[model samples]
Target: MKILFVCLGNICRSPVLEAVLRAHAEKAGLDWEIASCGTGDWHLGHGADPRSRASAQRRGYSLAAHRARQLCAADFRRYDWLLAADRSNLAEIVRRRPADATARVALALAHAGLPQPLDVPDPYYGNAEGFEAVVDLAEAIARAIVARDAE
Candidate 1:
């Protein structure tokens, strides 16, 4: 299974989700391929935000080598799933997805069993606490994905 996580910018939410989900999949012995990208091109080729990297490190996940990339039409054909961090990103992804693409696109939290999907908030302008919150959400989402796949 190949999964691609998306957000407005690759520097924060999407990259964090990529790292968290990859860790969970690896620990579960799943052979899933995971990656992340942003709808915008602003941070392309740049590493994740400093605060995001620091917050992830505190939770034992590394964002040390994560580089931001912009989402492209080809990604829809490459990944099995495209998981958006928030509703806005999800909408944009759907709008931009190729007509013949085979990827399933949805909010990352959709399978978490929540009554309603929750958007993974952008923490770029906030302090460490915001990033910490993102970690909490990312862990939950990762576990949910792993559990669902196991079933």
Candidate 2:
């Protein structure tokens, strides 16, 4: 299975999720391919935010190699699933969908059973605690994906 995680800028939440889910899938022995992208092009090719990288490292998930990229039409055809970080991102991705694309798109948290529809708040403008919270939420959702894939 191929899964793509999406967020606004791809520097914080999405990259963290990509690492977390990839690690879990590997440990579970699942043949899953994971990648992350952003709805916006502002941070393309940039590494994840420093705070986000630090927070993920604290939990043993490395975001060092992740580079932000914008979501493209090819993504819809390449991935089996496109998981958005929040509703806004979700909507943005949906708006970009090609008429012939068949990939399934949904909120990443919701796919993980999170009840909220809002996007994971951006931690860029916030403090370390905010980045930690983003990690916490991403970890929870990644575990949930692992569990679902196991079943």
Candidate 3:
């Protein structure tokens, strides 16, 4: 399965989801292709935010090699799933999806059976605690994705 995570900026939430889910996918022996992108292009080509990287690191997850990229039309055709961090981003993705696209786009948090269609709060302008919260959410969503793939 191919999965893409999307956020306003690729530096925080989406990268965390990609890293966390990739680890879960690997451990489950699932050959899932996982990547992340942003709705905005501001952070294109930059690595994940240091705070996000550190939060993932604390949990033994790595965002070291993650580079920010903006979502494009081609991605709608390339991935099986496009998981958005928040409602606005999801709406933007839906608006940009090609007519012939096959990707299933939705909020990443919902896949985890969390609050129905909840937005994984953006941690970019907050403190370390915010990033930590994102890690927690990412881990849960990763496990959920693996479980779904297993089924």
Candidate 4:
């Protein structure tokens, strides 16, 4: 299965989600392809934010090699699942979706059975704690996806 995680900037939430999901999938012995992107191209080619990376590192996940990139039309055709961090990101991705693509797009948090499918708050303008929260949410959702893939 191919999964793509997406966020607003790709430097914080999406990259972290990609790393977490990759680790979980590997541990579960699932043959899955995982990647991430952003709805906007503002941070294209940039490494994840320092705080975001630090937060993920604390949780035993690495975002060091992740570079920001924008969601593209081909992505809809390339991935089996398109997991967005929030509603806005989901909306942006849906707006660009190709009619014939078979990819299933939805919020990652919702896949995890989150009570509220709200936006995964952007940590770019926040502090370390904010980044940590993002990591926590990402980890939860990643695990959920891994579990579902197992079945």
TM-score of 3: 0.96
Instruction: Evaluate model 3: give its lDDT.
Output: 0.92
The TM-score obtained by model 4 is 0.95
lDDT of 4 by residue, 70-135 (tens): 998889999999988988888888899988888999888886677564778888887888999998
| Cα deviation of 5, candidate 1, in Å | 0.3
Per-model TM-score, in order, reads 0.96, 0.96, 0.96, 0.95
* Clashing pairs counted in every model: 0, 1, 0, 0
Give each model's whole-structure lDDT: 0.91, 0.90, 0.92, 0.88
Candidate 2 vs. true structure, TM-score: 0.96
Clashing pairs in 1: none
lDDT of 2 by residue, 1-151 (tens): 9999999999999999899899889999998999999999999899999888999999999988889999999999999999998888998988999998878998898888877645677788889998998888887888888897789
Badly placed stretches (over 4 Å) of model 4 are: none
RMSD of 4: 1.2
Q: Looking at model 4, which ten-residue stretch has the lowest summed lDDT?
A: 110-119
Lowest lDDT block of 10, candidate 2: 113-122
lDDT of 1 by residue, 1-151 (tens): 9999999989999999999999999999999999999999998899999999999999899999999999999999999999999999999999998889999998888855543538988888888898998898999999988988966
Model 1 CA lDDT for position 63? 97
Candidate 3: Cα lDDT at 27: 92
